[model samples]
Target chain A: MCSMKVVVCVKQIPDPAGNLRLDQASHNLVREGKLILDESDSYGVEMGLQLAEQAGGGEVTLVSMAPNSETSGLRTALAMGAANAILVSDPALGGTDALGTAKILAAAIKRAEPDLILAATESSDGYTGTVPVQVAELLGLPSVTFSKKVTVAGDKVIVERQTELGYDEVEVGLPALVTVTAGVVEPRYPSFKGIMAAKSKPVEELSVADLGLDTSEVGTAGSRQQVVSVVPAEARSAGEIVTDDGEGFQHILAYLERIKVI
Target chain B: MTLNVIWVVVDRTGDKVATVSLELLSKARQLATTVEAVTWGDPSQIAEVVGAHGAQTMHSVGDLGGGLPGPAVGAAIADQVRSGSSPDAIFIPQTYNGRDIAGRLSARLDRPVLTNIVDVEESGSGLITEHAIFGGTEVLRASFTAAGPGLFVIRAKSFAAEPGTDGAATTDNWNVPDLASTGAAKIISSHVEESEGPKLDEAPVVVSGGRGLGDAASYQLIENVAKLLKGAAGASRAIVDAGWVPYSHQVGQTGKTVKPTVYIACGISGATQHMVGMKNSKNIIAINKDQEAPIFSIADLGIVGDVKKVLPQLIEALEKRN
Candidate 1:
């Protein structure tokens, strides 16, 4: 693998489907004081770090799209093992849906000019599994996602892609974009040595305008998919457990028969 | 007036293919007055398959659908829409690769994507697509903007494969689509992994065990029942945390929300998280020693005896049936 530059896109979302407490009035997920790496994004982060480590010379820069106040996770990435970090934050970037998110990422990728860009296939919140593909479209670059294993040698990039029943092996040229699945690699726990090393890495902060993005082209205003409303699902009632082995066995069989599982 | 439905044919694994594309021919024979079925790759052979499916003609995007390569296929589809060959409704399989292509095409054309759909209904001039969210607990109703192009992803085994048995297959050579030049980012190597068994989301039966299974050996009853039923196996968060089962099979908010047709709970206390995963199942059967265990309320069938005892009898009955 060559020492090609790599950029990792990280998002700090509320834990996957955590009791997303909403403000009573605004109906926004109350996440001012809490955030973690979007569970799905871990795959992308781990993949990017693996690439850089394999190359042995180029660095992996952790870049995040979030409000300026929510930049700690990006720093945490630095603390983990990122060679450097950057925060692309601004009020204008708020409430960007997946497409808006992709547009923002495209601008960020262009600004970084990295040879490779990696991201999670989806954000657990949206579960659309569309951002990386959308980002590829917005950037007009060749991007294939759900890649399980990635190897780079010379000008070619080889990836093990997750398919419906099995996997397929495909090789493409360099400087492309890919989104990874969980099997990419296990993320390393940050040690004291890595945490201290991260402290010395440079972090560049950029606002929305600094990237030369058309603010109108990215954000809630640019998105077509709107969240009409999110209601808490009804609570399931306590279940019944029958103890009579004879009757219970019959009941279980009857239940399965009713559902046509038999 | 009826709307155009362009059914995108896919292979068994959900990957796009020419043979499966022809299956659309059988349905097209019914709806082709306004509906069109398109086979996206192999200009000559796929078009014949599409014709058999009832397409008056095929729309070919150069180097897509089969052996065309993933990224190129994606851009070619986008180029077709950009060139005004937009579909009123598009159908693709809900496989991993299919969704990636669907996601890309949706983004490139700036279309709203409703993914992993199970069924579609028409409402006046607009169409409604039904989607299952959070595994299956929530069913979302969506209608495309008036006469908007709708994308439908069909689950394998949900729709029966129809061959071109009823219609004569027609053939055409569609001119390849021209891809718009984009910034060139070189390709990388790719690999594929093969996964089998009933997928967690679509399995018909799921047998889940909890901490009451005692230890490793106690967990065997759950597996035996699952095997007898030809079903997927799952575990509660408690059992998973105890190292009784791999976390992949954990049924909870943090794990998988499965909508199997039948869910059998063994020794589970019915924690809220576990309930969230199996509550949407069509029929729930709970087996726990405690007669008042929380899992019984929602269960269609309740067995208050030990799962170890109950499961063997059930399996024996199944064996007798076979």
Candidate 2:
């Protein structure tokens, strides 16, 4: 019923549609060239903005931990009407696992002091799906994840938490954390005017030290898990290829019979 | 020399256990001296089922009266570990609520969770987890360096479910600790999406569509073919993210993993994300306009043609035969 301050965690990942490479030496993803907002996080940004708007008047802040102070992705969310952004970038943060990232985010989000924090259920790049909950725990807040639908009512936030078979309508108090599944909402494209306005938006930059996190607690050293090895998935060799060739359907039928699918 | 592992079973309806629970139990038995289970349901009802799948002790936390039981369950497990019954590791199936409990428990125990694990094997002094990252392009191996009670959230269908000779398990009532915030998030209502025919993961035959279906309306062709074959309809992450299909129908890394007898992909240039989910199917048939589509690589049979043209023919031929 009142103004609600929201924070959304966004990620700048290599475009999922493009080719991705791995740093063979470090056994990490090679982050290079242009980085864009992860498609999955767009829903979180949209949800945060909408929740803020519904509360009559509020601000949606973006928080991210990325390499090279990636603002391109945050700008896209800012263009969609977020008030501002906070990016914590450092080379020391490289090779950090999900838990380390959560520690950094938890500290940054605490500074924002939002009524709610929203994040994607998982990142398209890491696909860890653990940081949001970890952040909630670190802040001593309740969290509901895999929310397909979310609504703010009075002091409680209600969500339709997605499950394997269906969904459960869960209600949590304000200042809680929620990780949304994709398709929760249709993310709006930045209008020309909105894009122009985003250029003037404030983006606060911070380092791991600024968050009061020791360098040892926020990077590969702080990571609880170690990547023992990185190997390309066994390539599935090409199988029998058939052109339309008039008899293609019959060939498929015979193949189906061989597999006993019929 | 022996490891004690606890497997958390998600039993929402109080009747049936999730398939992934049994799958984890099967794998847990191999890596642990004792495979204990925790569930939020009547222990008597699920004891035999879990025991048949290798669980030795069942810690049951009966229904939480329409509340999300994550915090309560996590607290109960933490209490067990704190009271000198700490297990070597805790394995949880990667589900909505499972992550919630794992996160809460990890924070309570001050340990980190290794999530999205697709495979696990016994390693030197511990277990190693295999993660498929970057849309399943790379496989990374990791293990915990911490002490006991390493938490893991495992993916579905990662291991085969097998029944053990034991037909019953010793059950104990787990007392849920009263917490100020455990009751904060309450489940007012729940609904299962109305699906016709068989479920996607259990369906013997699955017909899936992707972005190449062009628009949402064209998705009907995928359904029609699936209907003709008495199979379930599925979709790739591309189509699901595009809002063409519900998340329940999505078959990929972030979605449900289906190992159907036959998986037919239409208009899908399978990304590694989509392939990992259904690549384990007994037979894969991919139909896409592009010959070099990644889907064709894993497909037992590949049709390099327009799906709009080919799907109609396949349906018509199946109808005639029927």
Candidate 3:
């Protein structure tokens, strides 16, 4: 039986279904509301768990960086069968950008010492889509992003990375980072028994200092960029509305002709 | 201009420069006195187009063979920066390889990258990037508080591609620096999926479907309508997530942003994420049974009807007209 230890990076985000509020002072999405497992990260967690199960006697560890030492999202991943979790939370990490976040995750991930790392291509909230690769570079490891399908042999990870035209088959050795695209695997819901067990699973919490990172290199002070201002975008005005009445085609045709697209 | 020089990382297929790259070059010209290009492939073939788009020089990282270009290209640029030759800011299109290269460069240089940017402007104080949030309802403007060489990853079609009076760009080749372990990932093989008609993002007209179309089988109606109009077929994130269509066909924040002359969203309820990508289309036409669908908010013309019935009539009518 193949034994592969995988570390999955998860993010706790404001529920997409609920109203989203930005922190006025920082211009960051306010996470004061009870944060939940970002829907995007669930796919990575599920993929990691599946890969571990396929490898027989292996474990999938969770790594997250959030404020208020958020463990609610970690519990969900644990309930989905992650063995343990590492949480890196500190007030100093408030204004961290993609690069700072990557530094924190890379440091926390090193403690897991896994054979592979999995993360969503982009988080639902920030959506910079650069953190995973940044983590890979900070750790000095190879990475493949936008992976739709992933498999592991004895010492190599094979990924089918999504591209504009199609997909590319990529191969890298063990201890590599991979960013999974959404819908790669259907994430399973947490079962009652699994949920109960997750409450007792070990959750190791670390601070910015705990991860051997200096405050000068993280948070608002450490950030190389900042939000200057935010303004409402110019709204697109709505035009004509009509019931189909078996005549909707005529309107579309008229618009097409007016635009000279025909 | 606020910035002295700016570099646009060109993404290309063979000799043809990607439209987004030209768009960035055009914007870069407006932001800086000098605009240059950095690309992975040989620059000799694409110098003309990039130059016409306002790039004065094309910096090539040489051919990467089958290996991924992220590590090599990023490393090469970092080396240049360290050697005292770097642009004030770099503009990279938010493509698969583009993000990878930007990420590597950010990590290597310990800089931050602003991504998902839909607009960029000079704020006098510095460069500001505008991001469309909440489905383009709000714009968040951000800038680099630190000094030198800011990295920006912009979405496709964020800026128009306009050719300047420049001729062919002078080409400069940079050797791919040794990447060691960082260059381990290699492309073993690539499969290009079969696509029909005009490319989705470049099509003058786009026809997209959502979950309201019922099942995977019903998606063909979107394709048929697109073909009838000589356009391209697209899908909302809902349908793509439901496995009704491939992710390539998805149009949303996490998908390809298309600013076609006309966008036809059929049976889509207009999720915020979906609208962020296509809401900027010159003309939007939404067809959904639910009249209150958020898609109607930005639609130039809204049809409250069942796509199952409406799409067929539309298809038949278009065919008769042709």
Alpha carbon lDDT of each predicted model: 0.63, 0.85, 0.90
lDDT of 3: 0.90
lDDT of 1: 0.63
User: How good is chain A of candidate 2, measured by TM-score?
Assistant: 0.96
**Candidate 1 chain B: 10-residue stretch with minimal lDDT:** B181-190
Winner of 1 and 2 under TM-score = 2
Better of 1 and 3 by lDDT: 3
Report lDDT (Cα) of residue B225, candidate 3.
95
Tens-digit lDDT track of model 3 for A1-262: 3788899999999888788878888788888868999888999999998888877768999999997988998999999999999999898989788898999999999999989999999988888899999999999999999999998777898899998778999999988999998888999999999999999999999999999999889888888888877888898988899999888878888888888877
DockQ of 1: 0.34
TM-score of chain B of each: 0.61, 0.94, 0.97
Per-residue lDDT of model 2, residues B1-322, tens digit only: 3465656555444368888888998988888878889988677877888899998889887777776767778888888889988888899888777878887787777777898899988787788899877556678898887677789899888999999789888998888887676447778887877799998998999999998889999999999989988899999987887888889999988888899999999988988788778887888898888987888878889988878888878888988888
Error of 3 at A28 (Å): 2.0
What are the per-residue Cα lDDT tens digits for candidate 2 across A65-166? 997988998899999999999999998998888778888999999999999999998998778788888788788888888888999999889899887668
Local distance difference test, candidate 2: 0.85
Model 1: lDDT of residue B50:
47
Quality class of the docking in candidate 2, CAPRI style: medium
